[model samples]
Target: MGKYDLLAKDIIKKVGGKDNILSLVHCVTRLRFQLKDESLADDEALKQTEGIITVMRSSGQYQVVIGNHVPQVFADVCRIANISSEKEGGQKKMSFREKSLDLISGIMMPAIGILCACGMLKGLNSILSYLGLYSNEDGIYILLNAIGDSIFYFFPVVIGYNTAKKIEMNPFLGLIIGAALCYPTINGVDVPLFGHVINATYTSTLLPVILIVAIAKPLEKFFNRVIPDMVKTFITPMLVLLISVPLGYVVIGPLANMLSNGISQAVLSVYKISPIAAGFLVGGFWQVMIVFGVHIVLVVLCITNIISGTPDPILAFTTFVTFTTTGMVLAMWLKTKDKSLKQIALPAWISGFFGVTEPAIYGILLPRMKHFVISCLCGAVAGAATAALGLKYHTMAGMGLFEIPALLDPAQPGVSLVRAVIAAGISLVIGFVVSFITFKDEEPSQTKGEEIVSEKCKKEVIASPLSGKVKPLSQINDSAFSNETLGKGIAVTPSEGKVTAPFNGTVMMLFPTKHAIGFMSDQGCEVIIHIGMDTVRLDGKYFEAHVKEGDKVKKGDLLITFDIDAIEKEGYSLDTPVIVTNTNDYMDIIAMMESGSTVHCGDDLITIL
Candidate 1:
């Protein structure tokens, strides 16, 4: 193996090798692994491995947080391990928390830093103003405001660049749209559309930037369709540039701005009438939106509010969810049976300290359905309190550990440091107390008689990897993940538990993070069994595998089993997804009539049509 291979191999072995991982993803500098269980990962060994920088367990992801050179390392891992991007059957259904983390991990990581910086700066400004140290008319104050405000003002450009990179669009085109939004000519232009000329400012607006990129995606596809192969790559981009830049200004840009303004107005109206109500709504649903990338839409509103010199009320309330999740993390840390979980809970708590809730929620807290309620109550209470107090955060930084002098001010009066702290503390107390009191330490199980199924699935069913509630593919909110591309699928309803394979196959590859598994069937179909939304960071310690590489078995074979009690103790999800990758080759896929049913081994699930 080359250096990359050696590095990948070393990490893989430490993470439980080929059989332990379920799935994998990467950011600019990190390899995010979804492991079958958390025990399989050897954090100390991984740290000692060559070519790694650091490891972080955050946002329910066991992130081998490598720096800038991570993509190459990830690619090497995939290549040597024969990891496939496509699954064997349909995609598995995932919970809202699991799905939300996936959306935020990539582009949002960078954006978060900026948000934090801006928040810190805004907080400092608030304090300075409160102390009467400087007036808003001061040049230094204005310059500082511009400095912190630039990222939010040109958010479209930043989002556009990231989105283009993520979907393989031209980064330059994204820049063009971003620049256009920042352009003074375009900013002041009033285009008569419908009954009025658009009076929109592109600065600090979210919708125009995202909308332009959204429009550019289809346009890029359209251009690709028309452009010939010989000059395709270059020509397609060029053509898209010419067409999209103008349309972004004339059509998509204006439309998106209008839509964002409308949303902003709606939010304001809600806040004005009842700040507490608005806070409750935002606090409750912010995480839900993250599940499907819908939160990105609200970002437009956030930017709009910020640009108008009023920070977003929704953004302030959103922290309630994180704080609540943090409390759950604390509770879980005190509750699990597995040793691996005890180790993870510490880091998750650290992340929670800095207000990075994904690791806690996806890694340690949200897996248990009952425990999740504790966090929800905490969120609701925190949100209600924050709103009732009319507490506002002027900066965009994260809460918990990331809390800094720049992000807090007690004198602003509407929303101040004392209020934010009180709300957050109350939320933590509620979540921790509820979780500590209510969470059952026992491993989840169903009575033998309780495992009843519909008559149709008697012979053709696949038992769920974990027991919980089952939901339909259509109900899953991620656009990037759908039934059509995920192949034939089933989602397990699990508050928490062990996950095992339903059929026999060669374990293709496993991730170091221990959040997922991948296998190849006898018929050459690829399969992926992902545990939870983003529990890749657990590193497989909580998972116990029954088989290893080259193992051959029939249906109901124990490929892997999980420690639900351990997972819950760590504050993570046990919602499992079993998906087949080659569904496109099949004529039809049939699901058994077992809605709201419990299943067991050797059961029939679907017939290939």
Candidate 2:
């Protein structure tokens, strides 16, 4: 009877049922499903489901878009379906590119937020030190610095744990191996092991720990299968730790370091060729890289550059992109006459100032193709200008206006800050001017203060789609329905299984499990008829669809059939909700059938104006 119980059941059924699901996990806003057969999933049905936003198939994950409420839905899904959330064995094969992207994203995504916060904190501390408000010797300063540095200092342990989980190995054993690499006694000391001298420290390094954990996966698996269960727990971890740590320091660590160093040098060489060209490339294409989830590579490179020596100029050169996006959104907000567009653009503009450009990019600019291109061009110009001025950051941190603190150098007074301000000014001016001049509103405008009231309000009545006892949608157990998020409507406790069309219209969405159907009335009202709460857990056992998406139907035409008694016996409520999904387009929606009254198919159930 939880709020998301019915939704969870519906999702499980639409995703090829519980048997098709091998493993499931959720991150931020997506439900990542690893299915036994990906093709068996009802992609369209899940996309049309009420709570779901969209569906994505990326990096071998059948991702269900659930917005911010994914965690709640994910929990309900696990409980209702009785499936483990852990990474399962015997995963389906994926392409090399897909596997690489998945591994990198898996390890970096979880830590990026914290890393950015730490970087911002360090930037703030530098600002304070420059202002004479707090010296480096101050307790507050030391504590703050330590807080910022902890993640990087113990970077190996963090990367080791995540990489181990990504590769399906023992995470604790990975942690032990990571810890061994950073242990003061072992670090910087040459140890003769297996005719090799191992003398490497893994303190802020990235590639070495990842390589070590990747190599440990098969070794751990070998030990698990061979060792007896009674001694497997201790022996498996011990062997993994003893072997991976020494080999990592002696071979894997050194080799990975060499590769990382080589790549870092190549990037530096590119920058040295013409800093202006390098800046233009990174600045212009950075957001594009972000869309494809490849921007993390740049972040890795910057971190490696900093670890090797000085902070790279790549981050510094690209700082103007966020500001450029913000400027474009501001221009759109000011130029657009549409109320809705202005509403979205205003908040997106504010977010851009703080270095979060996703809203501005996805919501405001990208939609207007020309505006997005203009912003990127402006970013490139600004980047070229910054490069010409030779501005560089000593540390990586948040971008946009917030990045100014990071750009400040204590050794030189006001030089980098002045250059940063000039770059931001150029980016803002170009973005605002170009977007304001080129972008045009294609949507038809509504006149203000010219309300045309019809002398007689026209009413359209929707016939009942189900034979049931009437109930208001407010009384439903689910808030998504009860609160009228989808739209205002009514519910019914079905006395039978057959669902007929309430009006003549095209079928918009028909769930593969036959539990729900969405219809657009010929009169233009969009509605969804959802049958039997939580009955989707039955996995199409008692329900059948008479029509598919895009089928046209007349009033009272059979659309779906189900076994009412069979569903009720499974402890699910047969209270079906018929909702007006496009309620905003109408002035009002009023229920016509009396609560608790018996209603048959084609009976007037609700009236819309």
Candidate 3:
């Protein structure tokens, strides 16, 4: 905490002191702040401040994207600002897709491992029971049942804890409501309330628990406010349990569950009516929804199907969407001439093959508009074709090519392997053709006609840490870079060397993993050169170093030379990001024209105010 004092003060000063911040909250990797006056804050300067990686303003909240150490910074921010660590509970204005993904990630991340483990256990139990190796009456079966079934049977408990955290409520009380839902006497009691008899059991049922928690949350807050502090510790929990839980079980649970079930059934009915329409809706919107974290509702529906032998259509469609992204990557590989581009596309193929398309979508295709649109359209068409032909997915597993076997349900004679293959092949060919038709041709290292012409004398700007070729910052991921907050910087791919010092500067901080380095220029600007995403796995094997922490280096000195061959061999690209770590301190950042080998050391590759 003491060591964090410097970082805390630095943030306060950079953000215009403690007074400027109105509210703050943190999710695992970022500190999301609401400010009183965004104009009074220098976002670029804040990004350059020590310990801050990037500043993003979106969704009405100023998001400080700190990689992994955000929790510490968040704690420090809370201490300095003298505010409760809890965020104010209010409605957030996120698109449906955004909310869905957030809810899904929140629910799934903490419990996915458990889901997998329990699913495996359940599968084993089924095998043993079928083979007569063990009886359901056996002690092993009972123990395993308790172990595996605890998660799904007591799902409310897990959902309660996670949802409470997401909405910034007391987790303890959330679990209490969850436990109450499972309370034997209460869950079994049936009363004819309003029109329908409340005969639904809480165990292994979704409607009751989720609805109760949703309703109970607000009720918990109301009780806390009205009750006296001295008596609240005991009286509040008692009151909420007495009023909220029963009220939820009798009214909210039954009603909400019926509504949700109706919605789920409606979705299924629609899919059954026209598989093609279902496929298009799920495929086109799957990744889009997933990106925002709202895909959880769909995930829960799928899990429900898994537990009850029912099936969900949305999950069935995601498999096709994943394959489509894979097809797009292969298309890029077939179309691109840049050696580095091929290197990136290779791993993207592997990741996509296994159903993790974030690296591929965000890394490879989304950067290019033609490719992105082409792949998505092809995916939509392919998904529709597959669904129209009555293709079905068998199990809930990773959504990729490998899952093809798991997806095949022999009983559903309407689905088959051949149809999947046909669908996959059609997707790939269409994606490839579309990409080939629209792909841009390879250009020279520097386009003379497009280069920005400057009247100032040409200072000898050195080559960026990345070397194969360079692209304008505007062409790279995230337009925020071009906003000049990162100061003037260029994107480059090092062909045959490692990053080195463009000019003399102090080594501000060398990341523990050695994949990145930050330096402060004599003029007080900060610069960062990061080799690649997840390149830390290289483990310094190919990094030939010339400097250590706190050591000063001159212009033209080698800071690090990487074995491009080794890196490429290990299935990684060498696209390095050389950024001005502290661009906010300056008024203006200017990029010089791209040039040839005539450039010298200590030249102005970029200019700062």
The per-model lDDT (C-alpha) reads: 0.62, 0.77, 0.63
Candidate 2 structure, TM-score to reference? 0.66
Best by lDDT: 2
- Please identify model 1 stretches exceeding 4 Å from their true place: 1-110, 128-140, 189-200, 214-242, 267-274, 281-304, 307-310, 325-345, 358-369, 393-395, 401-415, 432-609
Candidate 3 lDDT score at position 462:
36
Instruction: List, residue by residue over 368-400, the lDDT tens digit for candidate 3.
Output: 766676677777876787777566544444346
**Poorest lDDT segment (10 consecutive residues) of candidate 3:** 452-461
**Tens-digit per-residue lDDT, 1-609, candidate 1:** 555888887776666565556666675346777654544465655664645645655455566855445667877888776785311221223457655565445445446556767766766666677668888889877887777777877776777776565455666777777776787765766867556576557776665666677678888888888888899888887777777766677677768867867877887888899788777877776656543334555554565676555656766677656667777778878887767777867777766666555555545555555665556666777778777766655556645644533325434533466666677787788777777777656554565334432221233334355555666555544321232334567666565455566565577756544566677655555566777654665656787676665667566666666777777778875555566555554555566635566654445554543
lDDT of 2 by residue, 279-353 (tens): 998888887865554566777777777555466788777788888888888988998898989987887788678
Per-model root-mean-square deviation over C-alphas: 15.4, 8.5, 16.7
Most TM-score-accurate candidate? 2
lDDT (0-100) at residue 211 of candidate 1?
64
Q: Model 2, residue 311: what's the lDDT?
A: 63
User: Residue 388 CA error for candidate 2 (Å)?
Assistant: 2.8
